[model samples]
Target: MASLHAFANPARFLKIARPLTGWLFWTGAALIAFGCWAGLTQTPPDYLQGDSVRILYIHVPTAWLGMGGWSGIALSSIAYLVWRHPLANVAARAIAVPGAMFAALCLMTGSIWGRPTWGTWWQWDGRLTSMLLLFFVYLGYIGLARADREQGGDGRIPALFGVAGSVLLPIIRYSVVWWNTLHQGESIGLASSTIDGSMLWPLGFTLAGFSLFFAAVVLMRMRDMLARARNEARLRRMARA
Candidate 1:
Protein backbone atom coordinates (compact mmCIF):
# COMPACT_ATOMS: atom_id res chain seq x y z
CA MET A 1 0.00 0.00 0.00
CA ALA A 2 1.05 3.59 -0.62
CA SER A 3 0.76 4.43 3.06
CA LEU A 4 3.09 1.62 4.15
CA HIS A 5 5.79 2.78 1.71
CA ALA A 6 5.46 6.39 2.81
CA PHE A 7 6.80 5.57 6.28
CA ALA A 8 9.03 2.74 5.15
CA ASN A 9 12.02 5.05 5.43
CA PRO A 10 13.29 4.73 8.98
CA ALA A 11 14.06 8.43 9.26
CA ARG A 12 10.54 9.42 8.27
CA PHE A 13 9.09 6.82 10.62
CA LEU A 14 11.15 8.06 13.53
CA LYS A 15 10.25 11.67 12.93
CA ILE A 16 6.59 10.85 13.30
CA ALA A 17 6.92 8.16 15.95
CA ARG A 18 9.11 10.15 18.30
CA PRO A 19 6.48 12.86 18.78
CA LEU A 20 3.67 10.37 19.23
CA THR A 21 5.54 8.16 21.69
CA GLY A 22 5.47 10.38 24.74
CA TRP A 23 1.88 11.45 24.13
CA LEU A 24 0.74 7.89 23.70
CA PHE A 25 2.63 6.66 26.77
CA TRP A 26 1.41 9.39 29.08
CA THR A 27 -2.15 9.34 27.79
CA GLY A 28 -2.28 5.61 28.12
CA ALA A 29 -0.97 5.76 31.66
CA ALA A 30 -3.57 8.32 32.63
CA LEU A 31 -6.37 6.30 31.12
CA ILE A 32 -5.23 3.13 32.83
CA ALA A 33 -5.18 4.85 36.20
CA PHE A 34 -8.59 6.43 35.69
CA GLY A 35 -10.13 3.31 34.21
CA CYS A 36 -8.90 1.13 37.03
CA TRP A 37 -10.12 3.61 39.57
CA ALA A 38 -13.57 3.82 38.02
CA GLY A 39 -13.89 0.10 37.48
CA LEU A 40 -12.87 -0.65 41.03
CA THR A 41 -14.61 2.14 42.91
CA GLN A 42 -17.38 3.63 40.81
CA THR A 43 -19.18 0.73 39.20
CA PRO A 44 -21.68 -1.35 41.08
CA PRO A 45 -20.84 -5.00 41.65
CA ASP A 46 -22.50 -7.66 39.55
CA TYR A 47 -25.36 -9.27 41.41
CA LEU A 48 -24.04 -12.68 40.50
CA GLN A 49 -20.28 -12.20 40.29
CA GLY A 50 -19.78 -9.22 42.64
CA ASP A 51 -16.58 -7.17 42.84
CA SER A 52 -14.49 -9.93 41.27
CA VAL A 53 -15.97 -8.82 37.98
CA ARG A 54 -13.82 -5.71 38.26
CA ILE A 55 -10.83 -7.60 37.01
CA LEU A 56 -12.40 -7.66 33.55
CA TYR A 57 -11.21 -4.10 33.11
CA ILE A 58 -7.63 -5.37 33.09
CA HIS A 59 -8.11 -8.96 31.94
CA VAL A 60 -10.01 -8.18 28.74
CA PRO A 61 -7.45 -5.65 27.48
CA THR A 62 -4.51 -8.00 28.06
CA ALA A 63 -6.26 -10.75 26.13
CA TRP A 64 -7.06 -8.36 23.30
CA LEU A 65 -3.45 -7.09 23.08
CA GLY A 66 -2.12 -10.64 23.34
CA MET A 67 -4.01 -11.64 20.20
CA GLY A 68 -3.68 -8.25 18.57
CA GLY A 69 0.11 -8.40 19.00
CA TRP A 70 0.38 -11.54 16.87
CA SER A 71 -1.84 -10.00 14.26
CA GLY A 72 0.71 -7.16 13.97
CA ILE A 73 3.58 -9.65 13.63
CA ALA A 74 1.78 -11.55 10.89
CA LEU A 75 0.97 -8.40 8.99
CA SER A 76 4.48 -7.00 9.37
CA SER A 77 5.89 -10.34 8.32
CA ILE A 78 3.78 -10.31 5.17
CA ALA A 79 4.98 -6.83 4.32
CA TYR A 80 8.61 -7.82 4.89
CA LEU A 81 8.41 -11.02 2.82
CA VAL A 82 6.38 -9.56 0.00
CA TRP A 83 8.00 -6.14 -0.28
CA ARG A 84 11.36 -6.79 1.38
CA HIS A 85 10.73 -3.68 3.44
CA PRO A 86 13.28 -3.53 6.24
CA LEU A 87 11.07 -1.55 8.61
CA ALA A 88 8.44 -4.26 8.39
CA ASN A 89 10.95 -6.75 9.75
CA VAL A 90 11.92 -4.29 12.45
CA ALA A 91 8.29 -3.99 13.42
CA ALA A 92 7.81 -7.74 13.68
CA ARG A 93 10.84 -8.06 15.91
CA ALA A 94 9.81 -5.08 18.01
CA ILE A 95 6.35 -6.42 18.69
CA ALA A 96 7.57 -9.76 20.05
CA VAL A 97 8.52 -8.81 23.62
CA PRO A 98 5.50 -6.69 24.42
CA GLY A 99 3.23 -9.23 22.80
CA ALA A 100 4.70 -11.94 24.94
CA MET A 101 4.35 -9.83 28.06
CA PHE A 102 0.71 -9.11 27.29
CA ALA A 103 0.06 -12.78 26.65
CA ALA A 104 1.58 -13.65 30.02
CA LEU A 105 -0.49 -10.93 31.67
CA CYS A 106 -3.59 -12.30 30.00
CA LEU A 107 -2.97 -15.73 31.44
CA MET A 108 -2.28 -14.32 34.88
CA THR A 109 -5.35 -12.09 34.92
CA GLY A 110 -7.49 -14.87 33.47
CA SER A 111 -6.44 -17.15 36.29
CA ILE A 112 -7.35 -14.55 38.85
CA TRP A 113 -10.70 -14.02 37.17
CA GLY A 114 -11.24 -17.75 36.96
CA ARG A 115 -10.58 -18.51 40.56
CA PRO A 116 -13.52 -16.41 41.62
CA THR A 117 -15.86 -16.93 38.67
CA TRP A 118 -15.11 -20.56 37.84
CA GLY A 119 -14.34 -21.68 41.39
CA THR A 120 -10.80 -22.73 40.41
CA TRP A 121 -7.37 -21.27 39.86
CA TRP A 122 -6.94 -22.86 36.47
CA GLN A 123 -8.81 -24.82 33.82
CA TRP A 124 -7.75 -26.71 30.71
CA ASP A 125 -10.59 -25.02 28.86
CA GLY A 126 -10.33 -24.28 25.17
CA ARG A 127 -9.79 -20.53 25.41
CA LEU A 128 -7.35 -20.74 28.27
CA THR A 129 -5.32 -23.53 26.69
CA SER A 130 -5.20 -21.81 23.30
CA MET A 131 -4.09 -18.53 24.89
CA LEU A 132 -1.33 -20.37 26.71
CA LEU A 133 -0.22 -21.79 23.37
CA LEU A 134 -0.16 -18.26 21.99
CA PHE A 135 2.15 -17.20 24.82
CA PHE A 136 4.61 -19.92 23.88
CA VAL A 137 4.31 -18.92 20.25
CA TYR A 138 5.36 -15.40 21.22
CA LEU A 139 8.37 -16.84 23.01
CA GLY A 140 9.28 -18.83 19.91
CA TYR A 141 9.08 -15.76 17.68
CA ILE A 142 11.29 -13.77 20.03
CA GLY A 143 13.94 -16.49 20.22
CA LEU A 144 13.80 -17.22 16.51
CA ALA A 145 14.28 -13.60 15.59
CA ARG A 146 17.27 -13.23 17.92
CA ALA A 147 18.86 -16.41 16.62
CA ASP A 148 18.38 -15.31 13.03
CA ARG A 149 20.00 -11.95 13.75
CA GLU A 150 22.96 -13.40 15.62
CA GLN A 151 23.70 -15.89 12.81
CA GLY A 152 23.68 -13.14 10.15
CA GLY A 153 20.81 -14.78 8.35
CA ASP A 154 18.40 -12.89 6.18
CA GLY A 155 15.21 -12.22 8.19
CA ARG A 156 13.05 -14.29 5.88
CA ILE A 157 13.07 -17.32 8.14
CA PRO A 158 11.60 -15.42 11.08
CA ALA A 159 9.22 -13.66 8.74
CA LEU A 160 8.04 -17.03 7.50
CA PHE A 161 7.67 -18.21 11.05
CA GLY A 162 5.69 -15.06 11.85
CA VAL A 163 3.37 -15.86 8.99
CA ALA A 164 2.93 -19.43 10.19
CA GLY A 165 2.28 -18.38 13.78
CA SER A 166 -0.93 -16.68 12.68
CA VAL A 167 -2.60 -20.07 12.35
CA LEU A 168 -2.98 -19.99 16.10
CA LEU A 169 -4.90 -16.71 16.09
CA PRO A 170 -8.05 -18.02 14.48
CA ILE A 171 -7.87 -21.13 16.64
CA ILE A 172 -7.65 -18.97 19.77
CA ARG A 173 -10.56 -16.84 18.62
CA TYR A 174 -12.89 -19.76 17.96
CA SER A 175 -11.83 -22.10 20.68
CA VAL A 176 -14.75 -21.25 22.93
CA VAL A 177 -17.21 -21.68 20.08
CA TRP A 178 -15.88 -25.05 18.95
CA TRP A 179 -15.90 -26.56 22.41
CA ASN A 180 -18.15 -26.74 25.43
CA THR A 181 -15.78 -25.12 27.85
CA LEU A 182 -15.56 -23.49 31.26
CA HIS A 183 -14.88 -20.18 29.58
CA GLN A 184 -18.09 -18.40 28.76
CA GLY A 185 -19.17 -17.77 25.18
CA GLU A 186 -18.58 -14.37 23.61
CA SER A 187 -20.75 -11.72 25.25
CA ILE A 188 -19.62 -8.70 23.30
CA GLY A 189 -20.68 -7.98 19.74
CA LEU A 190 -20.34 -5.31 17.07
CA ALA A 191 -23.52 -3.46 18.05
CA SER A 192 -24.29 -4.71 21.51
CA SER A 193 -22.95 -6.53 24.53
CA THR A 194 -24.39 -8.56 27.38
CA ILE A 195 -22.55 -6.33 29.83
CA ASP A 196 -24.46 -3.39 31.26
CA GLY A 197 -23.34 0.13 30.38
CA SER A 198 -22.02 1.27 33.76
CA MET A 199 -19.88 -1.80 34.16
CA LEU A 200 -18.68 -1.54 30.55
CA TRP A 201 -17.42 2.00 30.05
CA PRO A 202 -14.16 1.52 31.93
CA LEU A 203 -13.31 -1.28 29.53
CA GLY A 204 -13.32 1.18 26.68
CA PHE A 205 -10.70 3.36 28.39
CA THR A 206 -8.52 0.40 29.33
CA LEU A 207 -8.60 -1.08 25.84
CA ALA A 208 -7.77 2.19 24.14
CA GLY A 209 -5.14 3.03 26.72
CA PHE A 210 -3.41 -0.32 26.48
CA SER A 211 -3.47 -0.25 22.68
CA LEU A 212 -1.84 3.18 22.66
CA PHE A 213 0.76 2.04 25.15
CA PHE A 214 1.54 -1.01 23.04
CA ALA A 215 2.08 1.16 19.96
CA ALA A 216 4.44 3.43 21.89
CA VAL A 217 6.45 0.45 23.09
CA VAL A 218 6.79 -1.00 19.57
CA LEU A 219 7.95 2.34 18.19
CA MET A 220 10.52 2.71 20.97
CA ARG A 221 11.88 -0.72 20.26
CA MET A 222 12.10 -0.01 16.54
CA ARG A 223 14.01 3.20 17.17
CA ASP A 224 16.42 1.39 19.47
CA MET A 225 17.05 -1.25 16.80
CA LEU A 226 17.72 1.41 14.18
CA ALA A 227 20.18 3.19 16.47
CA ARG A 228 22.04 -0.05 17.15
CA ALA A 229 22.28 -0.80 13.46
CA ARG A 230 23.63 2.64 12.77
CA ASN A 231 26.23 2.30 15.50
CA GLU A 232 27.36 -1.09 14.22
CA ALA A 233 27.70 0.22 10.69
CA ARG A 234 29.85 3.10 11.93
CA LEU A 235 32.05 0.68 13.86
CA ARG A 236 32.51 -1.51 10.79
CA ARG A 237 33.52 1.57 8.77
CA MET A 238 36.07 2.57 11.42
CA ALA A 239 37.58 -0.93 11.43
CA ARG A 240 38.11 -0.78 7.63
CA ALA A 241 39.57 2.76 7.81
Candidate 2:
Protein backbone atom coordinates (compact mmCIF):
# COMPACT_ATOMS: atom_id res chain seq x y z
CA MET A 1 0.00 0.00 0.00
CA ALA A 2 2.77 2.45 0.88
CA SER A 3 4.67 1.36 -2.21
CA LEU A 4 1.65 1.88 -4.43
CA HIS A 5 1.19 5.42 -3.13
CA ALA A 6 4.88 6.17 -3.55
CA PHE A 7 4.53 5.98 -7.30
CA ALA A 8 1.30 7.96 -7.30
CA ASN A 9 3.30 11.04 -8.22
CA PRO A 10 3.31 11.04 -12.03
CA ALA A 11 6.93 12.08 -12.18
CA ARG A 12 8.04 9.29 -9.89
CA PHE A 13 5.96 6.74 -11.80
CA LEU A 14 7.51 7.86 -15.09
CA LYS A 15 10.98 7.64 -13.56
CA ILE A 16 10.49 3.93 -12.99
CA ALA A 17 8.19 3.21 -15.89
CA ARG A 18 10.37 4.77 -18.58
CA PRO A 19 13.36 2.48 -18.26
CA LEU A 20 11.23 -0.54 -17.43
CA THR A 21 8.99 -0.06 -20.49
CA GLY A 22 11.55 -0.95 -23.15
CA TRP A 23 12.84 -3.91 -21.20
CA LEU A 24 9.34 -5.34 -20.72
CA PHE A 25 8.31 -4.73 -24.32
CA TRP A 26 11.41 -6.29 -25.83
CA THR A 27 11.59 -9.16 -23.41
CA GLY A 28 7.88 -9.91 -23.84
CA ALA A 29 8.23 -9.86 -27.61
CA ALA A 30 11.17 -12.24 -27.47
CA LEU A 31 9.35 -14.58 -25.16
CA ILE A 32 6.26 -14.52 -27.33
CA ALA A 33 8.33 -15.34 -30.40
CA PHE A 34 10.05 -18.15 -28.57
CA GLY A 35 6.81 -19.43 -27.15
CA CYS A 36 5.12 -19.47 -30.54
CA TRP A 37 8.13 -21.17 -32.07
CA ALA A 38 8.13 -23.80 -29.38
CA GLY A 39 4.39 -24.23 -29.47
CA LEU A 40 4.39 -24.70 -33.21
CA THR A 41 7.62 -26.66 -33.70
CA GLN A 42 8.45 -28.31 -30.39
CA THR A 43 5.15 -29.58 -29.16
CA PRO A 44 3.44 -32.58 -30.64
CA PRO A 45 -0.09 -32.42 -31.92
CA ASP A 46 -2.68 -33.59 -29.49
CA TYR A 47 -4.02 -37.03 -30.33
CA LEU A 48 -7.50 -35.54 -30.12
CA GLN A 49 -7.01 -32.03 -31.55
CA GLY A 50 -4.47 -32.73 -34.28
CA ASP A 51 -2.74 -29.53 -35.44
CA SER A 52 -5.63 -27.35 -34.32
CA VAL A 53 -4.42 -27.76 -30.76
CA ARG A 54 -1.75 -25.25 -31.58
CA ILE A 55 -4.37 -22.56 -31.40
CA LEU A 56 -4.46 -23.12 -27.66
CA TYR A 57 -1.25 -21.19 -27.27
CA ILE A 58 -2.89 -18.07 -28.65
CA HIS A 59 -6.41 -18.77 -27.50
CA VAL A 60 -5.70 -19.52 -23.88
CA PRO A 61 -3.51 -16.49 -23.31
CA THR A 62 -5.96 -14.09 -24.91
CA ALA A 63 -8.76 -15.49 -22.81
CA TRP A 64 -6.77 -15.19 -19.63
CA LEU A 65 -5.67 -11.64 -20.41
CA GLY A 66 -9.15 -10.66 -21.47
CA MET A 67 -10.45 -11.55 -18.05
CA GLY A 68 -7.30 -10.56 -16.23
CA GLY A 69 -7.29 -7.17 -17.94
CA TRP A 70 -10.68 -6.35 -16.48
CA SER A 71 -9.45 -7.55 -13.17
CA GLY A 72 -6.80 -4.85 -13.46
CA ILE A 73 -9.40 -2.25 -14.33
CA ALA A 74 -11.55 -3.24 -11.38
CA LEU A 75 -8.65 -2.95 -9.01
CA SER A 76 -7.60 0.39 -10.49
CA SER A 77 -11.12 1.67 -10.29
CA ILE A 78 -11.34 0.64 -6.68
CA ALA A 79 -8.15 2.49 -5.98
CA TYR A 80 -9.45 5.62 -7.66
CA LEU A 81 -12.80 5.54 -5.95
CA VAL A 82 -11.83 4.47 -2.50
CA TRP A 83 -8.27 5.64 -2.05
CA ARG A 84 -8.30 8.49 -4.57
CA HIS A 85 -5.02 7.32 -5.94
CA PRO A 86 -4.07 9.91 -8.51
CA LEU A 87 -3.11 7.65 -11.41
CA ALA A 88 -5.75 5.04 -10.90
CA ASN A 89 -8.19 6.41 -13.42
CA VAL A 90 -5.47 6.71 -16.04
CA ALA A 91 -4.52 3.14 -15.40
CA ALA A 92 -8.11 1.96 -15.78
CA ARG A 93 -8.57 3.85 -19.04
CA ALA A 94 -5.25 2.61 -20.34
CA ILE A 95 -6.33 -0.94 -19.71
CA ALA A 96 -9.58 -0.67 -21.67
CA VAL A 97 -8.38 -0.79 -25.31
CA PRO A 98 -6.02 -3.71 -24.94
CA GLY A 99 -8.48 -5.50 -22.73
CA ALA A 100 -11.20 -5.17 -25.36
CA MET A 101 -8.75 -6.24 -28.00
CA PHE A 102 -7.86 -9.37 -26.12
CA ALA A 103 -11.55 -10.07 -25.63
CA ALA A 104 -12.17 -9.76 -29.36
CA LEU A 105 -9.16 -11.89 -30.15
CA CYS A 106 -10.44 -14.46 -27.72
CA LEU A 107 -13.68 -14.63 -29.65
CA MET A 108 -11.97 -14.88 -33.00
CA THR A 109 -9.52 -17.53 -31.88
CA GLY A 110 -12.24 -19.38 -30.03
CA SER A 111 -14.32 -19.46 -33.19
CA ILE A 112 -11.42 -20.80 -35.17
CA TRP A 113 -10.69 -23.41 -32.53
CA GLY A 114 -14.36 -24.27 -32.32
CA ARG A 115 -14.88 -24.69 -36.03
CA PRO A 116 -12.40 -27.50 -36.17
CA THR A 117 -13.20 -29.05 -32.81
CA TRP A 118 -16.88 -28.37 -32.42
CA GLY A 119 -17.66 -28.33 -36.17
CA THR A 120 -18.98 -24.79 -36.05
CA TRP A 121 -17.61 -21.30 -36.51
CA TRP A 122 -19.62 -19.85 -33.61
CA GLN A 123 -21.89 -20.87 -30.83
CA TRP A 124 -24.18 -19.30 -28.26
CA ASP A 125 -22.63 -21.50 -25.63
CA GLY A 126 -22.72 -20.15 -22.11
CA ARG A 127 -19.01 -19.48 -21.92
CA LEU A 128 -18.92 -17.92 -25.37
CA THR A 129 -21.96 -15.77 -24.72
CA SER A 130 -20.66 -14.49 -21.39
CA MET A 131 -17.31 -13.74 -22.94
CA LEU A 132 -19.00 -11.85 -25.73
CA LEU A 133 -20.84 -9.89 -23.10
CA LEU A 134 -17.51 -9.14 -21.45
CA PHE A 135 -16.24 -7.79 -24.74
CA PHE A 136 -19.30 -5.56 -24.83
CA VAL A 137 -18.59 -4.47 -21.28
CA TYR A 138 -15.09 -3.44 -22.28
CA LEU A 139 -16.51 -1.41 -25.16
CA GLY A 140 -19.00 0.22 -22.86
CA TYR A 141 -16.29 1.17 -20.36
CA ILE A 142 -14.15 2.64 -23.13
CA GLY A 143 -17.07 4.64 -24.48
CA LEU A 144 -18.08 5.91 -21.07
CA ALA A 145 -14.55 6.96 -20.26
CA ARG A 146 -14.35 8.88 -23.51
CA ALA A 147 -17.65 10.58 -22.89
CA ASP A 148 -16.74 11.48 -19.33
CA ARG A 149 -13.58 13.22 -20.47
CA GLU A 150 -15.44 15.07 -23.20
CA GLN A 151 -17.87 16.38 -20.63
CA GLY A 152 -14.98 17.43 -18.38
CA GLY A 153 -16.40 15.48 -15.49
CA ASP A 154 -14.49 14.10 -12.59
CA GLY A 155 -13.06 10.64 -13.24
CA ARG A 156 -15.52 9.08 -10.85
CA ILE A 157 -18.13 8.33 -13.51
CA PRO A 158 -16.09 5.80 -15.41
CA ALA A 159 -14.47 4.60 -12.24
CA LEU A 160 -17.89 3.59 -11.00
CA PHE A 161 -18.62 1.84 -14.25
CA GLY A 162 -15.37 -0.07 -13.98
CA VAL A 163 -16.42 -1.35 -10.62
CA ALA A 164 -19.88 -2.26 -11.84
CA GLY A 165 -18.52 -4.04 -14.89
CA SER A 166 -16.63 -6.42 -12.66
CA VAL A 167 -19.88 -8.17 -11.87
CA LEU A 168 -19.61 -9.78 -15.27
CA LEU A 169 -16.26 -11.30 -14.41
CA PRO A 170 -17.49 -13.95 -12.04
CA ILE A 171 -20.35 -14.79 -14.34
CA ILE A 172 -17.98 -15.38 -17.24
CA ARG A 173 -15.77 -17.57 -15.10
CA TYR A 174 -18.61 -19.81 -13.95
CA SER A 175 -20.69 -19.87 -17.10
CA VAL A 176 -19.35 -23.22 -18.17
CA VAL A 177 -20.08 -24.78 -14.80
CA TRP A 178 -23.61 -23.45 -14.59
CA TRP A 179 -24.67 -24.41 -18.06
CA ASN A 180 -24.35 -27.23 -20.53
CA THR A 181 -22.01 -25.58 -22.96
CA LEU A 182 -19.77 -26.78 -25.75
CA HIS A 183 -16.93 -24.78 -24.25
CA GLN A 184 -14.74 -26.92 -22.07
CA GLY A 185 -14.55 -26.46 -18.33
CA GLU A 186 -11.44 -25.08 -16.69
CA SER A 187 -8.38 -27.15 -17.59
CA ILE A 188 -5.85 -25.09 -15.70
CA GLY A 189 -5.91 -24.36 -11.99
CA LEU A 190 -3.65 -22.74 -9.45
CA ALA A 191 -2.44 -26.09 -8.13
CA SER A 192 -2.84 -28.48 -11.05
CA SER A 193 -3.62 -28.59 -14.75
CA THR A 194 -5.54 -31.21 -16.60
CA ILE A 195 -3.48 -30.49 -19.73
CA ASP A 196 -0.73 -32.98 -20.52
CA GLY A 197 2.83 -31.88 -19.75
CA SER A 198 3.98 -32.18 -23.34
CA MET A 199 1.51 -29.53 -24.52
CA LEU A 200 1.27 -27.55 -21.31
CA TRP A 201 4.86 -26.28 -21.26
CA PRO A 202 4.55 -24.15 -24.40
CA LEU A 203 1.28 -22.77 -23.10
CA GLY A 204 3.12 -21.64 -19.97
CA PHE A 205 5.59 -19.70 -22.06
CA THR A 206 2.92 -18.11 -24.22
CA LEU A 207 0.84 -17.17 -21.21
CA ALA A 208 3.79 -15.57 -19.45
CA GLY A 209 4.86 -13.78 -22.60
CA PHE A 210 1.46 -12.37 -23.42
CA SER A 211 0.85 -11.27 -19.85
CA LEU A 212 4.12 -9.39 -19.80
CA PHE A 213 3.33 -7.87 -23.18
CA PHE A 214 -0.03 -6.76 -21.87
CA ALA A 215 1.53 -5.12 -18.83
CA ALA A 216 4.08 -3.33 -21.01
CA VAL A 217 1.35 -2.02 -23.24
CA VAL A 218 -0.64 -0.81 -20.26
CA LEU A 219 2.38 0.99 -18.86
CA MET A 220 3.00 2.66 -22.19
CA ARG A 221 -0.56 3.87 -22.35
CA MET A 222 -0.47 5.19 -18.79
CA ARG A 223 2.71 7.11 -19.49
CA ASP A 224 1.19 8.66 -22.59
CA MET A 225 -1.94 9.69 -20.74
CA LEU A 226 0.00 11.24 -17.90
CA ALA A 227 2.06 13.25 -20.35
CA ARG A 228 -1.02 14.52 -22.08
CA ALA A 229 -2.60 15.50 -18.82
CA ARG A 230 0.54 17.36 -17.79
CA ASN A 231 0.56 19.20 -21.10
CA GLU A 232 -3.07 20.17 -20.69
CA ALA A 233 -2.28 21.52 -17.23
CA ARG A 234 0.60 23.57 -18.56
CA LEU A 235 -1.58 24.99 -21.27
CA ARG A 236 -4.24 25.95 -18.75
CA ARG A 237 -1.62 27.74 -16.64
CA MET A 238 -0.40 29.59 -19.71
CA ALA A 239 -3.94 30.67 -20.53
CA ARG A 240 -4.39 32.00 -17.00
CA ALA A 241 -1.05 33.81 -17.11
TM-score of each: 0.98, 0.98
Error in Å for residue 86 of model 1: 0.4
Candidate lDDT values, in order = 0.93, 0.93
- lDDT by residue (tens digit), candidate 1, 1-241: 8887899988899899899989999999999889998999999999999999999999999999999999999999999999999999999999999999999999998898888788998978889999999999999999999999999988999999999999999998888889888899887888999999989999999999999899999989999999999999999999999
TM-score computed on alpha carbons, candidate 2? 0.98
State the displacement of the C-alpha of residue 26, model 1, in Å, after optimal TM-score superposition.
0.7
Candidate 2 least-lDDT 10 residues: 1-10
Which stretches of model 2 miss by more than 4 angstroms? Answer: none
